[model samples]
Target: MERTLSSDLAFENNSAAQASMPLRALSTLMLWQRRLSSRRQLARLDSRLLADAGISESQRYEELGKPFWR
Candidate 1:
């Protein structure tokens, strides 16, 4: 009975771990997608808008140059 209970617990733990993997990947992908979208929007900003946001053209260019993964 004890061995059976322990095995059941181990299996449950393994299942939880496996289930979390896809969630973690999805979270990362969403984060990267958001970053990409934000960068694209930033690229569309006019000079006045950039200044209003307190971001310089150089800073915007630098940020745009970065990969979404970063």
Candidate 2:
């Protein structure tokens, strides 16, 4: 009975993890997508807007050069 209970607990833990894995992956993907979109927008900003945002040309270039994961 004790062994059965232990196995049941383990199964529940594994099931929960499995269910959450895809959700976590989707969340990560969405986060990267947003980052990429924002970076692209940043790269397209005019000098005036960039200045307004306090971002220098070098800083914009540096940010644009980074991967979304970074």
Candidate 3:
């Protein structure tokens, strides 16, 4: 004879939310790198391309002026 248990189902662990600090820091660093790369690309966009993306020159300037950490 065998018996089934339901108590274990109530103890699910949230592993993702408990990620290690190094992993978290790596993800944050990647985000900053992406921001820097994107800003560089935005800085190189021509006036026509900027207008097509619905971004004005002043708006591009503001975004490009921001620090990568931001």
Highest lDDT: give the candidate number: 1
TM for every model, in the order presented, reads 0.83, 0.88, 0.72
List per-prediction Cα lDDT, in the order shown.
0.97, 0.94, 0.87
Model 2 scores a C-alpha lDDT of: 0.94
Please, what are the lDDT tens digits per residue for candidate 2 over residues 1-70?
A: 3534578898999999999999999999999999999999998899999999999999999999998998
Candidate numbers sorted by lDDT from highest down: 1, 2, 3
Off by over 4 Å in 2: 1-5
The window of 10 residues in a row where model 2 has the poorest summed lDDT is 1-10
Total clashing pairs in model 3 = 0
Residue 28 CA error for candidate 3 (Å)? Answer: 0.7
| Candidate 1 per-residue lDDT over residues 1-70, each given as its tens digit | 3534578898999999999999999999999999999999999999999999999999999999999999
Best by TM-score: 2
Question: What clash pairs does model 1 have?
Answer: none
Off by over 4 Å in 3: 1-19
Error of 2 at 48 (Å): 0.7
Among all windows of 10 consecutive residues in model 3, the one with the lowest summed lDDT is 8-17
